[model samples]
Target: MKLRTLLAVFGVALALTGFTLVAAPGLASTITLDEAVLVFVGLLGVLQGVRVAIARSRTAYEQVETPDPEASQDLPTPGDEFDEMLATAGADRREREMRESVRNRLERAAVATIVRTEGCTEAEAKRRLESGEWTDDPYARAFFTGSVEGASLFDRIDLRRDNQSRYHRWAVHAASEITRRSEGFDA
Candidate 1:
């Protein structure tokens, strides 16, 4: 049974017992067990009702009000939000890959240029690039002087406005040299 119903029944029983005791005063003194049991039951019912009331009030206060359905319509659905996040991440990955590709192409061209002009091995050219050491040759110096650590390809280009054109020229030159070597041609 519900707490309210149980408490109400106990209250009614207590009132009947009190009435019975008042109607028979002589018997009430003789019935010590019945009086004590009724008093205990009454106190228990009152305490339990108070506890139930407090619990109900606390839950009511803790309950959250529902947001208006019209207001919620303005919010993006989970799927739409997920798609937006995925698109942003994909774009970021593509941009990073592009930057890395440009950086690699610049390095390869610089390495190939050094090997062709200075008569050095590719490994030695790469080491020279890393060491920031340049030869007297203008072409080699052009590649070497443009080097900057941790800078993006565009940032490097911005540092020297001509570096962008230089990078393109060097990249073409590197590709041609690779093709020539692969084809077993001295040129």
Candidate 2:
């Protein structure tokens, strides 16, 4: 309660009272002086509330953002990082080892998911993949069992045209199928 703030508030209330009296001389005839003072006090309270709100909003905007280490712990998803690995693996011969690693990782994840959902042993889950009974997707079945020979003669030739592209497409489809199956879905 600084003297300056008190005086400013009092001055504002008084000016509002005078303005009300001058602007509506007809109302002044109906409303008593005590009621006029009460109205001025209420107006002052509303003005004070609005002033506080504006000051708070300005201060909130001016505050600097502080980083939290825990909040910054977001990591790239396994699928996203896998996509990057596949891109790098396809672009260069040196990433052949990474490509194989990625393939193994994808297969392992699928096998694990199948085992978890189907209540089967790992070997049985892999057997399902070998028989193409795990999923109805031809590319996924081919990719898992490493058999690209079952398509039509022309289709097989087309699939063999670019091994990298074919493998990438199979990998993406297989990943999606695995994700769908893991979520108790069949698509």
Candidate 3:
């Protein structure tokens, strides 16, 4: 059996034994034998359930980092001006594309959230989302909290690698960028 299963079984067994001992001492209690057994089983189920829940709650997820395609490859020697220029342009294009993709993802999510939660028009929602004061709206606040938590950088990389979804990958990057910009603006 898996370690979690084994541990849960052991915990339930212990609870059952302990409760049985306390409830039916020398068979002289007011409670009948059947009632004692029922109580013991109930305690066992609860103990097992608690152990399983705790085990599941403790599980954590992590993202695996993939090397950037541009950065991973060796650059041209310093003397090769044309090669270097091309490389720089390519890197810049990649960076811009990444930024644009992330921005689009964030905008869509933020605007949708604002529109849905605030009963606002798309234009107003888009404006509010771009303004960066998302916490003013109750729905926006909860949405941001959930998005940031779910799209955490560390977890999203692996999620991307595992082909979880395009939106998820972009959401993680966008959330981080938005958070960074907001921090600077606040300061």
TM-score of 3: 0.26
How should the candidates be ordered by TM-score, best one leading?
2, 1, 3
Clashes (candidate 2): 0
Whole-model alpha-carbon lDDT for candidate 1: 0.58
Better of 2 and 3 by lDDT: 2
Which regions of candidate 1 are displaced past 4 Å? 1-94, 135-187
Top-lDDT candidate index? 2
Across residues 1-187, which tens digit of lDDT does each residue of candidate 1 receive? Answer: 4667777877897799789989999878886887788878778877787777877777745568997676434766644543343334334545555435654655786677668766899999898866656342333334445543444677556545652344444333334444444355254
| Candidate 3 weakest lDDT stretch, 10 residues | 137-146
**What C-alpha lDDT, on a 0 to 100 scale, does residue 71 get in candidate 2?**
56
- Candidate 2 Cα deviation (angstroms), residue 30: 44
**Rank by lDDT, descending?**
2, 1, 3
Between which residue pairs do clashes occur in model 1? Answer: none
Worst 10 residues of 2 by lDDT: 148-157
Tens digit per residue, CA lDDT, model 2, 37-143: 78778877877777777667777455688886665677878568788888886678677798798789888988898898888999999888778888877777877
Residue-by-residue lDDT tens digits, candidate 3, 1-187: 3667867777887787678868888754666889978976887687667777877788896789997676566887753653333334334545555545444555675666556666789998766665545553322332334343323576546554653234333344445544444454421
Query: Higher-lDDT candidate among 1 and 2?
Result: 2
